[model samples]
Target chain A: MSNDNIIYPSVHSFSNLSLSDSSRTGFGYNPYKGPSSNAITPETSNILINKKTVSLTPTSFDSIYDRNILKKVPEISLSSFSFLFCEIVNWTRNNSKGIQDLEQRLNTLGYQIGQRFLELVKTRERIKYSKREIKILEILQFIHGAFWKSIFGKTANELEKSQDIENEYMIIDDIPLVSKFISVPKDYGNLSCSAFTAGIIEGALDSACFPATVTAHSVPKEGLPLRTVFLIKFDESLYTRENLRFN
Target chain B: MTLHSFYIFDRHCRCVYSREYTQGSDGGSTNRSNESDTAKLMFGMLYSLKNIASKLGDKEARNNLKSLSTGKFRLHLFETATGLRFVIVSDPAIDNLQSVLWELYSNYYVRNVAQNALSPVDFACDELLANPKFVSETDRFLSSLPVFR
Candidate 1:
């Protein structure tokens, strides 16, 4: 069982061929395309970019950013994240035309993060061999439990399906981390910073192939003034598919 | 103890990585399309097996199937939270296959492949296979396992 038996060619060989071609022509060559001419073998792994030599290596990128290298779950300071998030909200607020527009912008921003996170979280959970959540209820439980824990270090307080409507559901959180420091002025009128979180949920669900509309509502309780309820409204087609597949 | 092959499948049931060892056959004659067809069949079988296990298990228990054995070989499965499936086919006598799967996921797949920007999330990453460091490290890890001896 020697390594030689593995038939794949080295990526470095291709990289070397491109480097030689570029050096000989004294012009940048597209590495993706095959080498145009035989050229000098550069002494270093550096590549010329925009007329400046830039150091490059297979591992030049951050290894920590790699999901696998940091074996234990990574952590970021709450204070750091909070400050950064505050700046994002403030920036979004400054540019927004109105409250609705502000919320929409925040949602759009959160959506992309959510899409990437869905894959990241899913990749982390691959160890359990859990099947993809096909049922509406099952997927919600996943979001409320594993997904929530991954992001906030805690499970959601409650998950309730709306009794009046078949496709409506609610996930209640006592104090959403994103809005812990935010207080909406009276004029702001029902604005919840949790809207960002709602966008994240919406993005994750949308990418997972469960299209739904998610919105955050501020519903403060006696002691928990920052309480939030995320209302999820699934598309009618989701219900139709659920009925066809499960029933 | 003996290990035969390893496979990684993404959420979309696509084979993102596959490697065979100790099989003695070069498999050089097999084309890309044939390999893809084989992957599809394997994924379909695994999908059905998972669903069947879920339906047959007690409702309160975790539904994921861990491992199964036959007269010839055994199949070990480790599923990530995102629905990526890692399957290892090995000798029936092998022990602690789950740990091996964990090492492969955390050490090799996550570090060298997932973090690489050149490697796309949606397709099999041949660049990862071609990386000398990755291949060497994986070889070292697998060789250290008692089963490989």
Candidate 2:
């Protein structure tokens, strides 16, 4: 992070021939890059509350911003992240009024992650002269490809505009990573843990200035039990503004 | 080369952690408090300066305030996405300690404090980074650096 000359490592390197083959090539995926720089959270606010500064001393802590923004963080294990997510869900559930409130809280938690993730991933893209996503479809595709890949290590399975609804879109994941180990209890009726991922999508979209409401739903296929669909609903005025500005 | 001190601040502009490498004769309670006050003042100054610095650029000098220096010492600053700031005070002749500060943050700071589930996550507004392991490891790590002493 010190010097611009510092060479940042790239992802998906061919090294350390693991006995267990990872891909069809029979080689493990060894990225020269480090782990997720965003291992730590919980301090993030869903809303950008104006913090009245000028008091209190800094304790020894860090966040994934500034110099560390493009720096590849040590990868956070899925199990560990799941554990933390479980705890987050459990904690939010305590204060939630109902299933909706619980999901909302979970989404709130993912929102900040989304906002930060967008900037960090975009910077990491390091396109030399890449521009921001101005068009609606362009931004959505960016999210479905790069944004999802950065967070989940893979792109969303499908990015489809809603056939019935004008402003609605859907991003499908055959096997959602977050909810892989989680099972909603029988008593909880229809609680989906992917609300957190939905929140992340919403946060990233909103942060990118694409302002949308994203929610997660369980859409089971024949074999994929944990199949989740993220429903993204854009604001009514965005289409009008896009028409006026771009069209 | 001499590493004078180090400071960490969150987005709220609160100093989350600070350490001074005072050796021998530089000892006194009043001086210590004064040093802390100096840190607070330094934060305010840097915070405002960052805003100003971001604007003083044409096409690209913006948003890239890396270091500040005077005859006495050079201050290296690093900020994170979540708005955490890491500052290091070292000899003016030293090239830069931005890497060192980043190491401290990712290695000791994150592992010891931020990732520790039992420890407070919000080291910005609500909590202070008073973890014993974090402090001690940081002291060990900083003192061992070639720039120290």
Candidate that scores best on lDDT: 2
Question: How does candidate 1 score on lDDT?
Answer: 0.72
User: Which stretches of candidate 1 lie above 4 Å from their native place?
Assistant: A1-70, B1-149
Tens-digit per-residue lDDT, A145-184, candidate 2:
9888888889999999999999999999999888765656
Candidate 2 lDDT score at position A128: 39
Q: What is the TM-score of chain B in candidate 1?
A: 0.79
- Please write out the lDDT profile of model 1 over residues A1-247, one tens digit for every residue: 3433222222322223332344332433433343443233462222222233232355745654464632677688876787677778778888999888888888888887888787778887887625877789888998999898888999999999999988899999998998775545456787778889998998888767678889999898999988999999988877877888888
lDDT scores of the candidates, listed in order: 0.72, 0.73
Total clashing pairs for each candidate: 9, 22
Share of native C-alpha contacts between chains A and B (below 8 angstroms) recovered by candidate 2: 0.00
DockQ for each numbered candidate: 0.01, 0.01
lDDT of 1 by residue, B48-132 (tens): 9999998999999988878888898888999998788988878888755888888888878665555432234455433223433
Give the i-RMS of model 2 in Å.
10.3
